[model samples]
Target chain A: MDTLNKIINWFTDGSSNKLSYHYFSRKFTPMAFIGPALLVMAILLVFPLLFSFKLSFQQWHMIEQASPFWIGLDNYFELLANKQFWNSFGLQLLFVVVAVSFELLIGLLVAVLLNREFPGNKIIRALLLLPIFILPVVSGLTFRFMYNPQYGAINYFLKLIGFNSIAWLSHPETAFAAIIIQDIWRMWPFMFMILFAGLSSLPEEPYEAAIIDGASRWRTFLHITLPLLKPTIMTAIILRTVDALKAFSEIFVMTSGGPGNATTLLSVHIYKSAFKFWELGYSAASSYMLVFIAMIFTVLLVRNMFSE
Target chain B: MHKFKSWSRWKKGLFFLTVFIILFVELFPIFMVVTTSFKPKLQIWTSKSPFELFRPTFKNYLQVFKDRNFAKYIKNSLIIASITTFIALFLGSLAAYGFARFKFRGNFLLSMGVLASRMIPPITLSVPIFILISEWKLLDTYFSMILAHISFSLPYVIWLLLPFFKGIPASYEEAAMLDGCSRQRVFFSIFLPLVAPGLVVAAIFTFMLSWNDFLYALVLTSSRAKTAPLAVSEFIGQFAPEWGMMTAAGTVFLIPVFIFALGLQKYIIHGLAFGGDK
Candidate 1:
């Protein structure tokens, strides 16, 4: 009892043992601040991740109501063999590459154009940012309405232009292109916002030097701005790429991966597998594959971000 | 600055024209939705030109509020988002402050862990989360939805706020400590208030994320806790098209965020500058 009391005193009695107390608080303070968030992450994120990882190796159908039986690599083997899985994987790659490329190019152009002093530039930038905050579900619904074959605003404009109205979301190729267009419209501003911020902060010395050397504006931009903006560009692209891979609500609301699976990205495929087909284990396996793909970019992103 | 004055009349006209075209294209869809909300049903279907002017009606908004139980969904979304924002801000700021101020072992790894967690696709976790929520019999509960939201929002809040905390000079805290203030008091009265602008930005962004969330709400809540986004999506699943009510609901759902984004544009821009860089 005496020993226990002394040990407790050693911890609590700051005045008696100032050195120990100082060392203890230094270690304890950060943990006190950080521990709760770490605990929450472990419970909500880490645990579920491990649980899903375990489920990937088992065979379980939600509708069957049986226990998840150990299937060992069978689910992975089936996923590898599934034609739809490969198709979705290919589509996922195509979607991310195409959408991100257009967004980067267009976003950089707009940012460069608007980086100059202009009237109403602030309002225009703010207005451009509105789409980023609007709910994806709402955007999807609006785009769907705008793509309606009979009454949509888009087809109406096509008619005004003397072109035949396209059934935008009803056909396979058009459906894919339609979603990509909507995504670009919705996301380009993100790149613009980041690149615009980067552009605004760039040192004026480079432009001044380039002007003294009589370098053309285009050449100066390619040589000076591109190199300086590389970090911000990399950050924006990787962030968008990871987010684009997880694009679900917009696509789900727009086409529901429809026109006969023409637009099924990996995320949508996993969703349909779990909910529509009730293949829980299979979906878990597919989701891990998605995590794998995202992690590659995420690793590069983190390294790129922290390297400086 | 002289470049503008040096430009020819045609070049100046072209510049303004380009700006006008960009604005019009970007905002047209939003304009369509907002205007469609005010259009009478007959006008919506019969109007040949999307830009045609007409007398606006409040009937769609009236019906959405009276019949569709949209009020409940909005209430759920408000309750869940507000609570999640509050809790996330509290916990996330503390963690961010720790990561910024302390040079303890594994700080970099832990901070990176939080960043990496933020990048985890929510869809990837939806399956296990759904099963877990159901197992705990938490489906359709506000608790379940808020938990799921906080899981995503907390990491983001931490990531966003870390740079803000790091930007503050250490002398402030040291000065306070020497002035007989306890560490807790110093953090609350000094650090938090100093980071108030950051807190505001974090609050708005976190609230916006929670408010706009769809997947977690979809998986975790069936009816009682269904969010505004989910309810808006449900408008399309019905047999008959309800564009008027859908647009009205969407407008209501988005108006608060639009106001936040525009009204707080300065702070958001500052936040984005930091958000993009680090």
Candidate 2:
């Protein structure tokens, strides 16, 4: 930290030494720069995270309401060995992978389609964005009602086409599937927006060159369009994966991590452990673990994106 | 590689159809919500008959606005989002200017740390925030939620502002300095105007994140300070979840966000991805 301060001070001195760049020589006020942000962020977030960190070391289940035993690492030890915790973590991992992949593919296809110079494409593009704005809480509950066997739109549509209603939310396999499908629907619009932005921004030079080379449309897209879109595609995937791993509002609104905890991802699990079950310490530990997983994926995403 | 004008008529029709089908699927859920909002209460609950709207009434909407606290919820959301955006932007821009114009120590770590804060799932932090508010005796107050939201929005603000600051040529600031303008004067007159557009986009994205926030509001505030999404979620409870009331609330909540997005969709498209991969 001293080295850092010295390095910064050196830059300040050098710039001030030059009469042309002396405005920043305001008598060394470090507080003015990082102050407001620090105050806001510290009171709201950093303090809270640290608060949760210390709270996690104590026991807070039914044993204590206001005060707890300072059982260092006990909660984490139990959580680490807990079968249910690992299972839910595994579920979240799977959900993030599958959901992000599907969203990226569908979103890319929509972007490609929207990128075309069609007559009614503007209206389609506008309409395509409707889902991205819909609040996840409402979407989740609406789907809960929609997936209702007796009154759901899905079952109703199925019967109209002479098909039986699939037990959409109650059954284990279908419940998770239903949430994934709903998430895809909710998320694809934003993905579409990003991918479309990328496609639109691409210079026509590469495609033009490919055309002169007698490359087929498929070949040009594969060799040129896809390669050029690498960054945007990574952006969409990273954004989707992070959100998917933290999928809470929808699942909380819809399933509440129920039907024997089959749909309880790590986040919902954290919610249950902390708020619903009143185990603050255990929940805090679980949340940090959750943060660890998210960071891992995020780092991997950054690495992959930069690698290309 | 070929222009669409050279395509055969049959192929053109196929492409059009393909586009339509994809858009239809993409839009089906939103379409359902809009259409359902207009349908009468009984028609929605009784899934016995679908695709048929026997009666239409504004009663559900009327109830949403009049029966419950939809109006209060909207007012709360608007106030919180607006204040958060303003305060955050004011502070964020100043800090960004400071970091950009001034040479700083631990700048790299601090910047990376700020960005890293955003990567953590919000759910993880809610517990700590809840505890903090409780400790500070701020629970159930607008301040609690607003403060909580600032933490979430700040990282994005810094990240967004950093690039715009970097993009501004340093010669301009140097010139201002040479002209006997103080550092603060240069920031206000010279740099602030240049970064205003980027600031607007940053504010919009931050405001939306706060307005659309559910978890913080859900855990941090009770009924007195509840936002629209939180109020909307209340329609579902342990027993006898009121479908009509919920859908009514949902529609009202959706309308403001939808209208805001529709009006500013272009701004959103251009601006929200400020810190995003360029």
Candidate 3:
């Protein structure tokens, strides 16, 4: 009975001094708590990553294969030499930079304007979030329809301003710009909300002191508000950067990586290579390239933003 | 503060003008969708201004409802989303408690692992996951998509819920432990009730993630478990695309998310801010 009590006590309270039981519960309790999550992740994430690593080195015609054969460095070399793959990679970088910068810029400007209390502020804030909440696929299609050259609203508006009715999605440069516009519209509010939260939480004493010193609004904003808002801005930039890099559905729907691969971002490129071309090995290699690039970006952002 | 009060009439007009312009840019496309969905067939193709007011009808919406595939897609979406949310919240809360309460070796590594899992782009996982699911012969089933979604959402749930669990006082659990309750019992009885709001936040966020996902659903489920997004995308691909029908389907899809975003604006904001944390 005493021994049993000691066992139960050890298990329950970590009170017993027995090396084995102490070690067991010490390790097992936390495992008991976190093990299911780890297991789920292993099956769903880690295994897939390792499996893809192996597949990326192998040659397999997805439909014609009873077995995949290992091909050493062939896929990687092919992807390196492939102009289409490199173009897609460069385009993804460009897309991420342009879209995220515009979103941050517009979001900051709007957030600064809307930071102060005004009538119907709550209503305006709520309405601003609709684009963020709408389905990406829906947003893509809606924009696709609206960009129609002959009957679209955008062209109609452009004609009202005396500009020619441009084929927004038919030209490569305009098609890419059109996709960026849609992305900015959908994602800018995310930046706005974060900045607004930061703005509201800023210390009032600094602004009051600036006012007493007779600082101009621009000077006060430049010195005080901008410095204080750095962390939130960095956070917004990092989050938007990550999201823009993985953007797929909108580009998939709006242009399908057209007109002529102008907007073929990495995600869309990977999807097409894997599913459409059935080049499993090549697709896996390209995806890892994306994963590598994204990880580097995230790590850099985190280190920079959180180091202080 | 003084600037706001001492603003001239022109300044006030500019402020309101900026606000109105922003509002217009935000809502005009949405309003177009709503109006176009209600337009009859002939008016949809007209060269007249897309914004010009016309007689609205329910024909497109009725057609969407009458289609059998639309109903199946909604059912599949609901089933996949609910199951994913349930499983993610359940497992995620438990893991969150572990991270929150226990300061053990490798704790930092494990928590970091949870966050790092999110960094792996979903596209990177799609090929291997698709192959594995097909091999298991589980493709196009609720189980496959639900598992995929749970995998996608669990890391987020664990991260979001961890802070909430940490916010609960440890003394309550310690007192419960003194009274001879098991840890599981204490968690369920004492700590869970205190973190009810956290659970609600996590649930809604998880639901939204699963509901909004298109890539996983596109690859994993073809017809049997087709989601609304996939259905709508496919709808756009048909020859002689009906703009009215597409808009109607889009509007129907937008309703639930719109209500959730507006009604739970605070929680959404709180959750997003939480997500932005390191």
Quick one: best lDDT, which candidate? 1
- lDDT string, candidate 3, B1-278, tens digits: 43576778899899999999999998888988888999997887775697688887999888877863587788889999999999899889989999999879999778877876766788999999999999999999999998888777999899888867877789989897677665666677888899988899999888888988899989998888889888888767635667787899888877876887788888888787766464
Model 3 pairs whose backbones collide:
none
Chain B alone vs. reference chain B, TM-score for every model: 0.95, 0.90, 0.94
The model with the greater TM-score, 1 or 2, is 1
User: What share of the reference contacts survives in each candidate?
Assistant: 0.64, 0.59, 0.65
Task: Indicate whether candidate 2 or candidate 3 has the larger lDDT.
Answer: 3
Which digits, one per residue and each the tens of the lDDT, describe model 3 over residues A1-308?
35633443444544333555456656676776688788899998899999999999998779888778999889999999999999999999999999999999999999999987777888889889889988898899899889988778899989999999989999999999999999999999999999998898899999999989999999999999999999888878887787787789888989999989998989999999999988888899999999998788667665764575
Q: Which parts of model 2 are misplaced by more than 4 Å?
A: A1-31, A301-308, B47-50
Candidate structures ordered by lDDT, highest first: 1, 3, 2
lDDT of 2 by residue, A206-239 (tens): 8778868999978888989998988778877886
Q: Which residue pairs in candidate 2 collide?
A: none
Which candidate leads the pack in TM-score?
A: 1
Better of 1 and 3 by TM-score: 1
Tens-digit lDDT string for candidate 1 (B136-191): 99999999998899989999999999988888998989897677555555677889
